[model samples]
Target: MRKIVHIDMDAFYASVEQRDDPSLRGRPVVVAWRGKRSVVCAASYEARRFGVRSAMPAITAERLCPEAVFVPPDFGRYKAVSRQVREIFLRHTDLVEPLSLDEAYLDVTRNKTGLPTATRVAKTIRQQIRDETQLNASAGVAPAKFLAKIASDWKKPNGLFVIQPHEVLDFLAPLSVARIPGVGKVMEAKLARYGIRSVGDLRSWDIFELERRFGRYGLRLHELAHGIDHSEVKPDRPVQSISAEDTFDIDRFRDELGPAIRQLAEKAWQATRKTERLARTVVLKLKTDQFKIYTRSITPGDSINNVDEVSALALLLLQRVELPADTRYRLVGVGLSNFYEPGQLGGQTELFGNEF
Candidate 1:
């Protein structure tokens, strides 16, 4: 059995902001740009009490917590802190897989520190992070990555939780199907219609029946319900895509999306600058007021060069939207994908298409 440990920093970006500014400590802080179209990057625990959360509209965050302090995100400082945290992880194990700036999975099955158990390794790492960086991290130790991810969030905010190999089935039984990764509201409701509300209920169904109903995903559901996950903790996973999206306060016609698309394109383009990889494809995503999603993509002959190029191509993709003129959209997104290394861009063919 694998001994996996998942570490999650508590409100990482906001915590860093608070740690740097003593006056901001103990106050509700929302990390985001100051604008009507801006979405929150992170919220301090104090802000969470007021129902503020990441990816929420900044206007909505202000409405929810009128007294909250809004700070712009400082990725430079956050990345520095993240590097410190990663150094702490390396002290315990080399098999670390970072999910984002704030969370990671470590396979401590054979730790470098000679820790007696994965739980000890996790505890030590969390303590080291606290002592070195003055940051609190929650950790979960389990025999599998999915369960470890879930356990990390169970107690949350500088807490630790462990799931023993023998206790996996019992631990998962009563949990809602939504607790399983990838089981979103749509899938949950579909499962609920078939009397599958909990992991235990999903376990009772035959694998064949599940596959017949939900296709390939049903097979995955069956395996997870039985406490079986074969996925390994892959370290140093490369970035697959980068994107930014926004939902508007009022539904808008397709023609009205230019400003928002440009804004999101700028955000996405800025994100791409942080990586050495080049993106060949530009994707534009739109969600109708009715919640139907459509995506249009284009691959230029060369990698994108600047925010202006991203904005121009994204706007061009917007022209490809075939939805009715009367159709109003509630959300739009801009993304860059089809990554290539610096020397690998020659002989690339331009491509364009739309996906449902």
Candidate 2:
């Protein structure tokens, strides 16, 4: 069995604030701007008790916890601390897949520190993070990523849980179907209609029936319900593309479209720098309220190397599409694709076009 460990920092941003400031430890703390439209980036466990949560509007968070302290996000500081956590993970295994700024999955079947058990490796990594950064982390050890991810959340805030290979099914059976990755509100509601409230209920369904409803995701859900995920821990997951999309609650105006597209393009461009890859194509995607999907793409003859070029190309692509004044869109997305290493661009001089 491949030993996998998932580590997640508890209320990452809010916890960091609490740890750095002694007085914030036991208080309800929400990390976000105190603006009507600003969303809570993170909420401390104390704030959670009052129904504050990440992504909730600051106004809603305030209404829920009137006395909660609000702090703006400090991304630079968070990234620095995240790097330190990654260093600790590297000491255990090079097969680390970072899920976000504060969470990662590590395959520790063979570790750099000669750890014999995944649980021990998790403990050591957590200890190192606490000692070096005074940050609390939760870890889960299992035979696969799915179970390990679930185990990590079993106990929150400086906790560790393990799901052995033989105990996987039992550990998963009673959990809600919503616990499964990608089974969001819509899927959960659909499953509930079928009386499939938990993994155990899902386990009773025939594989064919599930496949009929959810396509390939159905088959994957079946395996997950049985606590079987065979996905390998790939250490070198390449950055194929960087994209950002937002679905609006209501259709937006044409005048508002320009600003939204620019915002998404900027976000995508910023995300591209997270990986050491160069983008060769810019793409624009839109989904109308009627669920019609439209995509427009441009491959610059010259390598567009910076955010300014990306934004300009995105705007140009947007202008190229002829949308009716009445055509309201539910979603808009911007993306960059055809990523290559810096050295790989040397011979591709012809790829750059006048668009650049």
Clashing pairs in 2: 301-351, 301-352, 301-353, 302-352, 302-353
List, residue by residue over 76-163, the lDDT tens digit for candidate 2.
6776777788878877787888766678888988888876788888889889989998989999989889888888988987899988
- My TM-score estimates for the predictions, one after another, are 0.85, 0.78
Candidate 2, which segments miss by more than 4 Å at Cα? 34-37, 236-284, 296-320, 333-356
lDDT per residue, candidate 1, 237-342, as tens digits? 6568999988888999988999889779867865664445679999999999999999999999988987789999999999998888999999999999998777
**Over 4 Å off in model 1, which ranges?**
243-253, 256-280, 286-294, 299-312, 322-333, 340-356
lDDT of each: 0.85, 0.81
Q: Over all chains combined, what TM-score does candidate 2 have?
A: 0.78
lDDT of 2 at 152: 90
User: Candidate 1 has what TM-score?
Assistant: 0.85
